[model samples]
Target: MKKIALLSFLMVFLFSCGQQAKKSETKSEDTPKEVVVMSVDQVLEQASDLAEKEIAVKGTVMHVCQQGGQRCFLMGSNEDITIRVEAGEKIGAFSQEQMGSELEITGVLKEVLTDADAHNPGAEHGEAEHEEDAETQDAHKVLAENQAAAERVFFIEGVTVKEL
Candidate 1:
């Protein structure tokens, strides 16, 4: 009888241990993972794959849109790259004072498709219209100059922003 009682207690202890382990597993699964913080250049380089993903990034505020104070531009530490970040409703508008200040921003990275015509309007028509008119030519020139601009353009939908 004593042996049977000991065995039953051990079984209960084992079962409770298993239950606790399962609970811990579920708790860990429910918790959100930490976001990796990156610089503007790193985010830009990985923009295609990182699009629509939430991430944390640090950069110096280069410019803030004055109209309604809704958006601001951030530049990498080396000043090699810049990215746009729109302020979230929770955080409200970004003040002009934030410009030139290093900021740590947590947000969702987004990619906006550039206008197809802006990239190559003539190509869609074919080689027959090789000689684009002055206006068209001017537009093409502007587009060519800003070719990298579109590819590098990424907006961070700001979740939080703080000076660092």
Candidate 2:
């Protein structure tokens, strides 16, 4: 009788442990997925369709354009679509210091229609804010809001930055 009781208790303990492990595995699989990762060419191909669309892409950081203490642009190889980052946003996860490094950027891909969007002739990146208007400032906010609506771009908020 004593041997039977011991065996039953052991079986129950083992069964509970197995159930707990299965539950933990299910929880891990439930983690949120990331935005569709695209290559530079694929991103450009879908750029028109993705206007105002939040995108995440990995590419080599051809250059880093900095301005206004903390503002910076993480340019991909094509130089067509650069990811704009703000002062508080510059934890060095992506910036000029990261030039020549490969990186993954997640932001709202926008069209550079105006001259202001064009590169300046004579200014090192990280010098000064070109346009301090409410419009430009709001642009950053819009990007942030847009990102929030869909998905978290970088899993680490800012640390997920990849230098391609």
Candidate 3:
């Protein structure tokens, strides 16, 4: 009957369409993974969590180091929020021409103790030290606390730069 013919035709059409869909979709290991790019504000907000990790940030170039183009600062929507980007071995230097230009920079986040924190290694943190006999870690505990307390500068060591 026509009903049986119609059902068979419908099943055949559905199977053919499914085969085409499978052929159209493909996954290759050689394909590069997509990187999650953060804004300047996000980078500053998540500085501690993102430290030592490679990150991509988009912002407007606020200023560039003039001496030898070693570094540059990126400004977020909030003028107070700015992240420093330093030239890595790959980047020779940030040019003055980048000033006011919007850019997406990829780099590894790094933090260093400030001069004030460096002056006093073991300032006041006493309880953080766990080892009783091995007492040399007092400075390490205090320095870790100081670094956690925002007494350090967070900068990104630039790996690549793209102007957008």
- Choose the strongest candidate by lDDT: 1
**TM-score, prediction 3:** 0.63
Write one digit per residue (lDDT tens) for candidate 3, span 53-79: 999999999899999989999999977
TM-score of candidate 1 versus the correct structure, residues matched by position: 0.69
> How big is the RMSD of model 1?
6.1
lDDT at 11 for candidate 2?
A: 99
| Number of clashing pairs per prediction, in order | 0, 8, 0
Question: Against the true structure, whose TM-score is highest?
Answer: 1
Tens digit of per-residue lDDT, candidate 1, span 57-130: 99999899989779998998665678989897976999998988999999899877677334676566786846
Ranking by lDDT: 1, 3, 2
| N/CA/C clash count, model 3 | 0
List TM-score per model, in order: 0.69, 0.42, 0.63
Note the residue pairs that clash in candidate 1.
none
| Local accuracy of candidate 2 as per-residue lDDT tens digits, 5-124 | 999999999999999999999989998657887766676656668766667767665544455324444455567755554324534433456666666766666564433333332353
Q: Give per-model CA RMSD.
A: 6.1, 13.5, 7.1
lDDT of 3: 0.84
Candidate 2 vs candidate 3: which has greater lDDT? 3
Residue pairs whose backbone atoms clash in candidate 2: 66-125, 66-126, 67-126, 102-163, 102-164, 103-162, 103-163, 103-164
Error (Å) of candidate 2 at residue 90 is: 7.3
Where does the lowest 10-residue lDDT sum fall in candidate 2? Answer: 151-160
